[model samples]
Target: MKRILITGANRGLGLELTRQYLERGDQVFAASRQPDAATELQELQAQYPDHLFPVTLDVTDEASINAAHAAVRAKTDGLEILINNAGIYPGASADEPTNQRLGQLTGQGAIHVMQTNALGPILVSQQFLDLLQNGVKARILSLSSGLGSLTWKSSGDPYHYSASKAALNMYMRSLAAEVGHYGIISVLVDPGWVRTGMGGSGATLPPSDSARGIIRIADQLHTEENGSFLTWQGQPVPW
Candidate 1:
C-alpha cells in the first residue's frame, strides 16, 4: 500500500481523497489546520484507525508544515504520494470587489492568496523532500486550476485567484524539472469544477468524482509525465 499525505483534509476534495485512499488500504496522513475540530476526519479515523493518521498542518505557516513533517516522519520512513491540496479561493465570488478585476484587486488579498496557493506547496514539498526521496516511485501532485492556463484566459477576472494558480503551475513545472532525476514525478492537476466550497454550489461535478479521477491519473503518473498539467481524467491541459 502507498503511504500518502494530503493537505486540507478537513473538507471537500481533500476529505474525499483521504476517504478513498483509506478505503483502498493506503496509509493516509490527513493534514488539517485543526485536526481535533475536524468532525468528519475524526470519524474517518475511527473507521480506519490503523490506516488514517490525522496531522496538524497549516499550509500557510512554515512552522506548522515543519511540525507536520516531523509528525509524519515519526510514523513512516517515507511518503509515496504528497498531495499539495491545501489552498484558499479568496474572493471566489465575483461579488467580492477585491477579486473582481485588476483595478479592484487588493495587494494584501493577492499576496495572501499567492502565499497559500503558490508558496505553500513549495514550502511543504521542501520539508518533505527527504521522505519523498526515500519512497518508491514517489510522486508530488499539486492541485491547480484550468483558470491558471494562459491559453484559456477567455475572461480575465478574479485577479488574485487566477494569478495565484498560474504561479503555482509555473512553480510545479520547475519543480518537476528539478526533481525528475530523483525518480519523482511532479505535476499539476485540475480537478474540474466540482461542487465544493471553493467551486460553489452551482458546480456540476461532485467532489468524490473529481477525487476519484485525480487518483486514477495520479496512479498512472511516471517520469515521462513529469511537469505535465492534466485534468482529473488524465487529459493534458495546456500550460
Candidate 2:
C-alpha cells in the first residue's frame, strides 16, 4: 500500500481523502491544525488502528510544517503521495480594504491569501522532498481551484481566492517542470464546488464524490501529466 500524507485533515476534502485511502488499506497521515479537533478521523483511527496516524499542522506556519516532517521521518523512511489540501477563503470583506471597493481585494489580503493557498504548498513540498525522494515512486498534489483559472475568471465572486489559486497554478507548473526528472509527478487539481464550509450550502457535489474522483485521478497521474492543471473529474483545466 502507498504511504500518503495529507494536510488539513480535520474536515472537508482532507477528511474524506483520509477515509478513502485508509479504506483501501493505504497508510495515511491525517494532518490538521489541532489533532484533537479531528473527531471523525479519531473515530476512523480507532477502526483502522494500523492505517491512520493523526498529525498536527498549520500550513501558514513554517514551524508546524517542519515539525510534521520530523514526526513522519520518525515513523517511516518515505512517503508515496503528498497532498496539499489545506486552504482558506478570506472573502470580499477581507479584500475590500486594500482596494477601497467592495469586490476589490486589498494587498495585505491578497498576500496573506497567497501565502496560505499558494506558497504554503510550495514550502511544504520543499520540506518533504527528501522523504519523497527516498521512495521509489512519488507524487505531489496541490489542491488548486477552478477560481484560479485565468481563462475562466471573466467574472467571479471570490477575488482573493481566485487570484491566489491562479498564482498557485503558476507555482505548481514551474516546480513540476524542475522536478519531473526525479520520477515525481507534481499536479495541480481543482476539486470542484463541493458542499463544505468553503464551498457553501449551494455547492452541487459531496465530499465523498469529490474525494473519490480526486483519488482516482491522483492514482493515474504520470510524468506526462506532470505540470498540468486538472479537475477532480480527471479533466484538464486551463492554467
Candidate 3:
C-alpha cells in the first residue's frame, strides 16, 4: 500500500481523494488547517481508524508546515506520495479584495494567493525530501489549474490566482529536473473544472471523477512522466 499525504484534505477534492485512497486500503495522512473542525475527515477516520491519520497543516504558514513535517517524520521513515492540493481563489471571496478586473489587484491579496498556492507546496516538498527519498518510487504530484497555462492566458482572468499556479508549474518542473535522477517523479496536474468551492457550483464534473482520474494517473507514473502537465484523464496539457 502507498503511504500518501494530501494537503487541504478536509473538504472538496482533497477530501474525495482521501476517501477513495482509504477505500482502496492505503495509508492516508489527511491534512487540514483545522483538523478538529474537519467533520468529514473526522468521520472518515472513524471508519478507517488504522489507515487514516489527520495532520494539522496550514500551508500558508511556514511554522505550520514545519510542524506537520516533524509530525509525519515521527510516524514513518518514508512517504510514497505527497499531493499538494491546498489552494484558494482570490476572486471567489469578497473578503479577499481581489477582483478579475484590470488595475484592481491588491498587494495583500496577491501575496496571500502566491503564498498559499505557490510557496506552500515548495516548502512542504523541501521538508519531506528525505522521507520521499527513502520510499520506493516516490512521487510529488501538485494540483495545478488549466487557467495557469500560458497557452490559455487571456484578458480579465484573476491575476493572482492564475499567476500563482503558473509559478507552481515552473517550480515543480525545476524540481523534476534536479530530482528525477534520484528516482522521485514530480508532475503538475489540472484536475479539471470539478464542482467544488473553488470550481463553483456550475462546473460539469464531480469531485469523485477528478479524484479517481488523478489516482489512476498517479499510479501509472514512471520517471519519464516527470515534469509533465497533464489533465486528470492523463492527457497532455499545454504548458
Candidate 1, residues 44-114: lDDT per residue as tens digits?
99999999999999989999999999999999999999999999886655574455476776778788899
Better of 2 and 3 by lDDT: 3
Itemize residue pairs with steric clashes in candidate 2: 98-106
Locate the minimum summed-lDDT window of 10 residues in model 2: 92-101
> Is candidate 1 or 2 superior in lDDT?
1
TM-score of 2: 0.93
* Candidate 1, poorest ten consecutive residues by summed lDDT: 91-100
TM-score of 1: 0.96
Where in model 2 is the C-alpha error above 4 Å? 92-104
* Candidate 1 local distance difference test against the native: 0.92
**Each model's TM-score, in the order given?**
0.96, 0.93, 0.97
In model 1, where do residues sit more than 4 Å from their true spots?
93-100
